[model samples]
Target chain A: MNRKRSVWFLTLFSLVAVVTVFYVSDRPSPFDGIQLFSDDTLDEVGLVETSSTNEESFVSKSNAFEEMRMEVTEKRSQLRDQLTTKVGSNEFTAEQKDEAYNQIEELVKIDSTEAMLELIIKSLGYDDALVRIEESDVFIDVVSNEQSTKKASEIIYQVKREWPEAYNVEVSFDGQ
Target chain B: MIGILVVAEGANDKRIQNSLIKTLSSVLQISPHRIVIEEMELEDK
Candidate 1:
């Protein structure tokens, strides 16, 4: 009788444990809720900030694209400065200086091209467009608030016409 | 070769999707399969 009782107790315990595991796994996590709430709050804050500005708000319409272009320009300037320093340094070999110069030149070219492409995209009615050139590939991110594939194709056609030697040009839209 | 990804609020709209694909194909001279469209909620600032 004792053995039978022990068996029944073990069965009940196992069942409870399995049920607990399933229940825990099925329940939504509190962290997920917190994250979602925080994201919503941030979005609200952004909206408020944009709305508060009357005059500057017009420029802020393409804030993302402007920020991206600024960042690229800053990076290009830094790279150029570094290349100049390296080339003038007597510690580095001629070959090293040449390589550094070549790399920096290539980077500057890409940066300039990206900036130009972004300007073209903006002129094509995608004011919030970003262009990034990596190696031979070009990536375009256009705000899709009023963007269409037709506008995207127009940008692509312009890129091809201007830079036919580019390896791959990829365009993506960023909604946020 | 250009790969296009369009993120729009109404990405599920059939008209937008069809027009985007058709435009990309004609302009890029590539198959419609090459252009990818994704939908996301974007907050306008």
Candidate 2:
């Protein structure tokens, strides 16, 4: 009768252990809150992300003019730095130094000329203006209501009167 | 001379008294008598 009691006790202990293991394994994981969140909350998160993206896009689009100017300025700055370094270093001869200095002066003159032209365009009743002069090209961008071939021709004539270099003049109108 | 000789841009526009020209003159903040606003004519090629 003692042997029979020992066997019954061992069987009862194993059954209890197996039941406890199954109970723990069948429970929901701690990270199951994904299902607990409402659909409204997820939609709100998506809307916030979308709105922020739109705001960034608008800012970038509106700053196109400024971005162009900044790029030009940055390029000029780098070129000027290189020229200045060339002038100060002994690797360049006197003639080379003089040439670099003249290039620097020419860059200054180009900046002033573009600025003056832009001012004149503004004085001409344009809302805003930008003038960019490359070696063989002239770019004139104006904010105005009228964008006509006649107006373009007149702008080219006016620019040629001032600069008079055989430049390929291109005129752009921004009605915004 | 204390005169402001201004040239309007992009050819001459024939307006009925040119309200824009008058507006330009008014905004200059100068004596009306000392302002000369002229619209540049496109030269015949």
Candidate 3:
């Protein structure tokens, strides 16, 4: 009778264990919310990804635009240098250069010879501007103080002798 | 000696009735009363 009771108890315990295992496995488990993303959430994630991609593309395009601008500026500078060099080398006739320069000068609005001379002197840093107008020929004297007197006189003499149209350079220490 | 009296850049423009005097004096080679220098006034740049 004791052995039969022990067998009955073991069978009951095994059956309870099997039933618990099957119930736990078959029933829906509690979700930790990790894998519970809805379709709307998925769509939001997709939109975020797309926005990031677009931002990246925008950055790339901005960079490309900057590169193109730099290239264009460089090309323009190169062309200006080439043209200035050609004009200086007498590739263009005096009249032709003068006419072209006058057109550009008018468009850009350079009125005074002094300003033009200053620009010419400044441009000597990079390249010379083929002087279209003879400053000394047009002006009798360059107004200069004691400091710039010598330079002014030198330019005057040079221009007076260089251009046949200019007979003399009347230089004065004062701008009268 | 009729010379044109002109103004200086930094100084005021002094127009002399007898311009030849100032012109000759400024030129220094000729007598002031003998030469004439035309006076042209351009605005300061």
Candidate 4:
């Protein structure tokens, strides 16, 4: 009985193996139907540039205002970090750390002052603006529909109102 | 000012923008021209 069963199993196994071999041996690749190099798909996809008429767009676009702001922030932050490192390092004396702390505080105050001035300028009716304070000079450039003397006067008035100091203020506008 | 800041986002338009800008200017004590509703991105809202 065992010998007869073994013979049947061998016959069935051989038959299944022969069928699978014939089924896949000469068949063209089934993936041939898929279009892997279609140009139409690429043509349908394109870049979408951000186009907005707000301060957000002014800051987001690859423009001078955003670049200037980012550069200022980067440089200030790097300076702040160096001061922080000096304050934290064990090699520094208490007096040195105190000086570093004072420098960091000054940096913070400068950053806050610049931000406040910028916000005030933006609130004063310009589309967007950047304010930079260097020692005794306060530099500002704004965007608006008209860059008249009257508009510049209004901006200077507002800037001085918020920041009352003897700093030499310079105002410029771009009617873009 | 933004329309979405006052009313529903989908209902924002030119009229709504003008209205919202005035409202924002008055509330924030800022000039209307300083606030551009059209240039404000929805995601930034």
lDDT string for model 4 (A54-165, tens) is: 5544544326675566556546656776787899999999999999999888777776887888888878776678888776678888876577888788877877776676
Query: TM-score of chain B, candidate 1?
Result: 0.68
Output the worst ten-in-a-row residue range by lDDT, candidate 1 chain A: A52-61
**In model 2, how large is the Cα lDDT of residue A60?**
44
Among residues 3 or more apart in sequence or in different chains, the pairs in candidate 2 whose N, CA or C atoms overlap within 3 Å are none
Candidates by TM-score, descending order = 2, 4, 1, 3
The models' CA-based lDDT, in order, is 0.70, 0.70, 0.45, 0.70
Stretches > 4 Å off in candidate 4: A1-62, B1-45
lDDT of 3 by residue, A1-176 (tens): 99999999999999999999999889766884755676665766743334575555444443443343334333433444445565577677888777665654532332244345535433423121222333323442222224366665665555444454554444333221
Q: Is candidate 2 or candidate 3 better by lDDT?
A: 2
Please provide, for model 1 over A121-168, each residue's C-alpha lDDT reduced to its tens digit, 9 standing for 90 to 100. Answer: 778765466777776677888765555677667878988876776679
On the 0 to 100 scale, the lDDT of residue A77 in model 4 is: 56
Give the fraction of native contacts in model 4: 0.00
Candidate 4 per-residue lDDT, tens place, B1-45, comes to 322234446423344555566577678865444454543447866
In model 3, what is the error at residue A102, expressed in angstroms?
5.5
Chain A accuracy as TM-score for every candidate: 0.56, 0.62, 0.30, 0.59
Report fnat in order of the candidates: 0.00, 0.00, 0.00, 0.00
Better lDDT candidate (1, 4): 1
TM-score of chain B of 2: 0.46
Instruction: Indicate the TM-score of model 2.
Output: 0.50
TM-score of each: 0.47, 0.50, 0.26, 0.49
Global Cα lDDT for candidate 2: 0.70
Query: Which residue pairs does candidate 1 place in steric collision?
Result: none
